[model samples]
Target chain A: MSQELKQTPLHALHAELGAKFVPFAGYDMPVQYPAGILKEHIQTRAGAGLFDVSHMGQVRLTAPGADAALERLVPGDIAALSPGEMRYTMFTNDRGGVLDDLMVTRRAGDIFMVVNAGCKTEDLVLLRAALGDAHVEYDEDRALLALQGPGAAAALARHAPGIAGLGFMKAATVAIGGTEAWVSRSGYTGEDGFEISLPGDAAEAVARLLLGEPEVAAVGLGARDSLRLEAGLCLYGNDLTPDITPIEAGLTWTISKRRREAGGFRGDAIIKAQIADGPSRRRVGIKPAGRAPARAHTAVVGPDGAVVGEITSGGFGPSVDGPVAMGYVTRGCAKAGTEIELDIRGKRHAAAVVKLPFTPHRYAK
Target chain B: MSDVRFTKDHEWVRLEGDTATIGISEYAQEQLGDVVFIELPTVGADVEAGGDAAVVESVKAASEVYSPVSGRIIEVNDDLEATPGLVNESAEDEGWFWRMELSDPDELEELMTAKDYKAFLEGLD
Candidate 1:
């Protein structure tokens, strides 16, 4: 914690925007701007919200069989990915718990991956040791930006013409103002959006260009967390960790049929076993019947007053206009509509198990 | 007929005779951002100075609204149960958290006046 914090390419812009900074994952990042988290969350759903994702690690795997090597580390069917196709997958430990969840895109001969800011260092170490240091490279010069919302494509289309034609989970290399970027028609906000990885130096200009667009606004980590929470997306350290397996965390869909059947990846046996026989605990969406939000670490009890689990993440869903959360509960209580109680401030409150996401996804598939 | 004072924790107390109305300061509400819910202390509850008397849940975090001085709760703000954003809209007046009878009026002397509170906020940044 004593070490100096890092800054992104858009740090000065965030300061100019009147952002309140906070230290996140070893970086001095903006938590929220003057408009605040609520407005930003709503804006991301209604219009395009730009996020500086440069803190996330942009890694490259340059090898003939990079997909195959990546497949060994993740349970996803990486080798089956067609060129320019992206898949959401997780790096699992030998015990089957997630090391880090990442996005893997199959490039021409090599592969590209984006990892969480906090987990990147360890993820790099793991990848280098497995895929050889010569093949694994994390480019510090690269900066990433996420333009997310229903109007994201419209805003970006003005800058990059072909972006409108991009389908969900598809990737394209497009030029914006002479800067080449690896653009993907995917985002974690459960909305139709794009994740653009471009040169760090050009990042500010591109961000400025997008922000100049009528629909785009600069968002921060605070709204990003709330938006993803309402979207039912998992945050790395909170909802996912080394102690939680892909199956337990409700990410079994990430494991391809081939990998599930062949069982060759790290912790394949355990993961596959859990796949066949359901995990003891399963992550589920929570809806509080009242206004009070049950924040993270609050204990969840079942109908009979038995402790079922604990809330991984919880907060006021600005769009939903109430409290929504996600957590791992006993398999018996994971079903939708199951009654539960959350111990908030020493009092139990009635809540219900609901299907994620709290809102419907509007992907441009 | 009322004296206004501010606490270091950012709560505000408006003392009129023996009864005082309490709420967070504008500076505090802006910091918390978009109040979604608030848990008010019950009427007739006796609370000590600096003790937690209300819970304010913002979109980003949950913070305790402490009593600026020792008092016995006489009334609670029920409006916050439905319109918590009032804290953000009118933090000092309409968004007042509760009303209580001061058990020890001398404690108000330890709080900051309007000028002092403004200076405190200045020193913060």
Candidate 2:
């Protein structure tokens, strides 16, 4: 029997907007609205796009030493995180592979974390087993929304004043639609945006309020995936997996200087060694030769016609007006401008290694 | 107007004498959203009835367009290579995927007529 799919708090609203639903992370989530993925993607780059990301897991950990306790799990310098600061890090396993990537925010009295929907159950189990005294509170009562693009701030500022002042990677409690919500100036789309975590009961009201803005259109997972792909952001299961390490994924930067020197997190030794003598393979941005997209699982071919790597995330980038993809390749072939061949369905297509963020990041600094 | 027949896979065949013009239905294109790329079977390629003959790719996913009747491809849509979105704009007319010489005209009898196809679509909802 097929498993019953879950619905987000904004499901009714999405249906009202004529969103096409698809199964993702066990949820019947909207993949695109009537405007379609291409238009939604371009709209997010040009104007404001509102997204219902409530399927993502949200939790709050409270303890006297929550920051230090959290540091023992991930390589990020959570202990140094001041209140209202958010850091992106991954849960590394003993073998140095990434279990999942998550966002850790230092709230006033606790650490607020948002994990991938597919990994939430496993993450909670791991966190509960590892965090001895820290109280892990699953905030299922809340919903997450992302307002992104060039015009996002202007549209959001009308609802919550002073939100535009919060710098990138910063978080603050703001009143949105007359309800308290945690607003963070960070997003996966590489656009100027804010992620608002609010009460589930108030989600629909605030969503409608945001959609009421002329600049804000409802964007779905289809555009969300394309937007993040263009931004070069890694999706949890695709670009990252149990077999991929932060070092191999080119996410070592998330391992801060202090965290690198202290070396106490899980798989620290393996990660340290990989950092010292670069990883065998690294994730790099790929641009195919022509209009035909090289999708995920497409083999990366070397000069000798040997399979060297495989595309993890890929599709037609509406904004780029061409095919953009990301994949893991031997370190030697990971450099920008390196010529590679993508074998799509028994045919080889010419491609090149390029710097990430296929489109320039337009974060609000 | 020539008699148009549709297959369960959403491909449409417009029969005229010994040749038939094939393309996906407008409903199929609307369901697939914006078409980005399409790969058509080469001319002179023999395709079996109800077999894959073309691929239509949208920004979201790729779908195979099946041949409605056994035939040898006489003409393939080359314009789709540069302007695949034409399929979304005119799926039944200018967006025809190919023209084929019917190997067995009796195969057309197995397909659904326009009225039956319309009822089939309604039943799907």
Docking class of 1: high
Clashing pairs in 2: none
Error of 1 at B30 (Å): 1.5
What are the runs in model 1 whose C-alpha is more than 4 Å off? Answer: none
Per-candidate chain B TM:
0.98, 0.97
lDDT of model 1 at position A312: 97
After the best TM-score superposition of candidate 2, give how far the Cα of residue B114 lies from its true spot, in angstroms: 1.3
User: Top TM-score: which candidate number?
Assistant: 1
Candidate 1 chain A, which ten residues in sequence have the lowest lDDT sum? A157-166
Tens digit of per-residue lDDT, candidate 2, span A266-330: 99999999999999999999999878888888899876777789999998899999889999999
| Model 1, span A86-163: residue lDDT tens | 999999989998889999999887799999999999999999998999999998889999999999999998889867
RMSD of 1: 1.1
